[model samples]
Target: MSELRKKWITAPLLKLIKKVLPPISETEREAMEAGEVWWDAQLLSGKPDWDQLLSMGPPQLSEEEQAFLDGPVEELCRMVDDWKISFEDRDISPEIWEFLKKERFFGIIIPKEYGGLGFSPTAHGEIVTKVSTRSTCVGVTVMVPNSLGPGELLMAHGTDEQKQYYLPRLADGREIPCFGLTSPEAGSDAAAMVDRGVVCYGDYKGEKTLGMRVDWHKRYITLGPVATVLGLAFKLYDPDHLLGDKEALGITVALVPTDTEGVTIGQRHLPAMQAFQNGPNWGVDVFIPMEWIIGGRENVGRGWYMLMSALAAGRGISLPSLSTGGAKMAARTTGAYARIREQFGIPIGKFEGVQRRLAEIASVAYVLDSAHKTTTRALDAGHKPAVVTAIMKAHATHGLRQAINDAMDIHAGKGIMDGPLNYLGNVYRAVPVAITVEGANILTRSLMIFGQGAIRCHPYLFEEMLAAENPDTKEGVEALDKLLPKHMLFQVKTFIRGVFHGWTGGLFANSPRGVGYAAKYYRQMDRYSAVLTLVTEISLLSLGGGLKRKEQISGRLGDVLSQLYLLSCTLKRFKDDGSPREDRPLLEFAMRAGLHNIEVSLMEVFQNFPRRFLGQLMHFLAMPWGHSIRTASDRQSHACAELLMEPSETRDRLTRGVFLGNPGDGVDLVEQAFNKVCATESLRDKLKKGGIRAFNREAIDAGLERELISGEEAAELREAAEAVNMAIQVDHFDHLGTRES
Candidate 1:
């Protein structure tokens, strides 16, 4: 230890820091301590190692995973009639339920030894996404058990006995599992839950043994009504100090069998009328053995950490996959409808307004799908990536909302009038459910993403916090002495990079070779990353603890970080796919949109910085040339929109993994019309050149009579016209909109 340096610098600096450090609540500290940071740390570094991202090989599905997706997944999608599930039946048919059990759909994330499919996270995500396009109810059914449910928890932190017992049951659907975390009074603030387990002797299975008397009421629990076993979170108290010196054991998670006495489980809440099994359950005095505690009694008071870690990987998969499903469904169906349905004697897709909407739909699908694939691969590679997972949950669900809104706007009448043929109707109603669950978008954006990200991703900030908090005064001061200089150097370098990159538009920024069309995007991302790092440091320095209360500022910062990650994923997707020529429009749209969003977010943060002059200065440093970037351009939008309308390889690749259903369904009809339209595009163009603008029986017959088209070509044109007519026709009900009622 350098005694002279410590006496001169560290002693006084530590005293000032202690005076300034905010009082961190137990909950906040536990949250800050949970989950590992990965690529997010690089983006926050301002000098991301481009090679690190490139070194992550392309995402791929194993042969077993691919076979499952092709086999049971596809068959399951075929069996779900979304309209009937949501409206008439209000549940998947009993047959489908049995099919889920037999196929181990609920056990996708469990290992093979546990009798699960033992699929990779990517496979799990792909299955959920593919099924979601068919039915949200079934998707939720599959997603819950695999995600933050008991299955995931048990696998991660279960006792050996708990794993051996519950994992196999959960895998084969012998036990339908749901985790009860959210209570009426403690929704987002789960740590504030009043659910309690009092330590005491209790009777169990004809033997008196050590256990706890638990009482809890939990709501908004997915799979609750139908679950055979339940995972519970509650505060444990040892008023008698039976098993601990402290009365409070913090939050603990335990497994409770639904058949246990005093347990209630047979009810359901209609979530947006989506027909998923979610509702409240209560236990007046449920007694569970000490061994029932997840990871056993030694792991008490660690429930919050366990839940946070589970959510880190789970959030990256389930909701984002579902969100991407909604987006791809919207893109495929809306594009087909826009192409086949005529307005003013031309495909409505030709309208610029519609094209704009279509562009958003397709691009949102593209970006969200890319992120879903990329993030799931990270999970598969054993990276939890908490901050990035939160970003995925927030942005992907928001993207779903945006894409569905555009689809509804385009399908105005069809979307508004919900019926059997309204493919977008059920998904539209389910948007709010996705946005509200996992974590509400408002809270996730305004707080968690950047609020948690800043300390977790920063190289020295968390260490600095720990150093400041160390109980030994001399040790704390010494730690700070070593860290402070490095921290200051990092801030200086970040500021320089921000200014330099902004002035030059990131010309010499590090980027991989063969990025081709994405080289400029990579450079801009690098610039924005530096700008974000610089502004984040300045904001912290200026606002201090008060920045936590300034959610608007934090949210804008979170937006900047999220856009950088999404943009990186988009570029990675392009490179992984060998930068296909056919997919360039989708890639370009995604990159342009992501970079534009980054610019807007950075500008917003700078403009809203607490110090007005400082804000202005940072703004100029971020964009010295008066706003060099704009939203995705109209030409890009046109190209992306046109890509959606036609039956192109790019469109297929973008919209793949969605359910096409039977041959006569609404989506099926749309598909038929789209293909027929493309097939007859040249034939119709030939007729157009012969002065037939609109396809009609009369026009086709006249063309054949005039010999401008062959008889076979005339038949093809007539068939195309009929297909379009059938596709654009809205369903009319017999009575009350159901056939069997």
Candidate 2:
């Protein structure tokens, strides 16, 4: 591989991340000052609550907690699972939506006063998980209105009258609200939206331009076909030179009854979120009173800000909860099926390869769950975490995609087919869209997180800085960019300093696992924080002339930014939880897997750009995976070994992954274990139908208990894995503080 290519594939910078992680306090405010990771508010200071496990106490299974957790998640699982039923029957039952709404699913996000559940983010997540487990379509419909629709807007900015008039009806489904934002020319670029309005001033001066004459077309509107009221976003222009009314402002949100005069919502257009009611709603020259503005007349021309604040919380809730639940459901179903489905006289679950993935799927499920909860709590705390939400959306979705995929791998031929056996396939098809929506993961990371952070999270002079950059003075505009770098660099240096002060501050950081998770935390923050800054500057410059171009840049930024946010959240949880593995099992697992994934996806995205820029694509494609990235290879291998211990015939199913997997690891271990088990036909045949329990029973019969791992074996495993990992690190040139190759 080329030197740059090596850097892209390996993870050398992991060292730096490890160094910086311990100092991160319970508050992420420190990251803002040191990382220049700011926006919207003053940067916070202090350390993270790294000793979370201690604070949380042990992972004891309370009877109530266990019961709640173990309850028929099947009801929830069927939501996404039935897609297989649909493809097999080529249709779905109406019971899907009915089953959800009747369960009070529709009311989860609405406040209790509004005749709804008035649930918190976690509650909403649980409901979505249930919906997505059986059907992502159901998840989509259930999530849209309650989480991101009119209810969110009204709560945030609506006038008392508006909330009182609309929220209750919406909660009961007596009136369904649809948000009209994206237009034909705008997909990810909402600010460049083409819809606009001219104020309708009366000939009388007292009522100058209190209403607007609007024209616009919007597509990809969920519930558009069935909406009773439309929350429309359009630019407000001073038509007839009317300036007194709020309608004279530039951009505004208006709630229009679909039946109002001069208003018409068009036909339903096919959209990829095709499972439920989805369509495009268009309008031209629609007349709407200025009172229709969300949050009332006081906040006109501020639609973007209003919408964005609500979306941050909504995004965190939707994809993370839905995706995590879906993945867990898929894994649960697939694992059970693999255990029961026999081949070569043994069940598939006995295979080491399958075991490895199961472990990973389980690990991911928990991590995603924890991370989802963290973000939800943040929302409940009223954090309004813009950057954090993006991260949750991207990271959770990415992990879910993998968890579902791992299930498919174990399912093999059964998974590949479009039948009840291949239940995981339908949700898998939607992987890309999940990542692309809500500003796309790219923009969430690369632009919005850091760009917004630089302005929002700075210490001391954040407000002055924002004012400096956005000053009305021409000189201020010209000099602000230059002033920004000095302050930004100072923050970056603080981050470096804080990293060194870690663990020295406490016993937790010194613990091996705490160290690992902390390392991952800082490494990720450092790796992307700078690149995000660069992308932000460039995007801002690009937008000076071509305002819309920033949207595309924003999308790219979102992807990188989203990854960073999720990774940080994962690290925070891992460190705080105090897992006991040598490398801090949970922490290490999250890191190795997260790093490997982020790197690969980053590479794919980076390489997707013009190939001609390979030599010096500094401003273009950035490196993804590098040697600094950590590896959970040791754990993965151990788990895989357990999975491969099935019968010989079941071993055949693993043939595909072995060829596709890394060449260095002893790929034959799984197959070899299978053959050894299958040598005795009688034993293999007996275990085929229920190999997992049977094999596990046999292990008990064999008396292989209390394996603390001999020092010799531990040394050998470490030697082998460490060597392999070292090679990867060197090959990827990860030592350099670079994000993209």
The most accurate candidate by lDDT is: 1
Q: Which stretches of candidate 2 lie over 4 Å from their true place?
A: 1-103, 201-210, 245-248, 342-360, 460-467, 470-568, 571-586, 595-630, 640-741
Alpha-carbon shift of residue 259 in model 1 (angstroms) = 1.6
Tens digits of per-residue lDDT for model 1, 1-741: 489878877877776665665556777778777779999999999999888887787778999999999999999988888888888888889999999999999889999998988988999999999999998889989998888878888999998999999898888889999899999898857668999999999888889889899999999999899888889999999999988699998999999998899998757898887999898999998898999999999888888888998999999999999999999999999999999888766899999899999998998998999899899989989999999999999999999999999999998897887666789988988899999999999999999999889878999987877787863488788789889999999999999998899888888776778788778878888888888898888887777777888899999899989988988888888888888887887877777777777777777777777888988988787678766776777887898899989887888888999999777888888899888988998888888888878778998998888888999999999998999877776766676555532
**Using TM-score as the measure, which candidate wins?**
1
Give the per-residue lDDT of model 2 (tens digit) for 451-549.
454345444334334334334544434344344457566556544433333212212222223354366355444444444433334333333323223
Per-model TM against the reference: 0.97, 0.66
Query: What's the C-alpha lDDT at position 86 in model 2?
Result: 41
| Per-residue lDDT of 628 in model 2 | 46
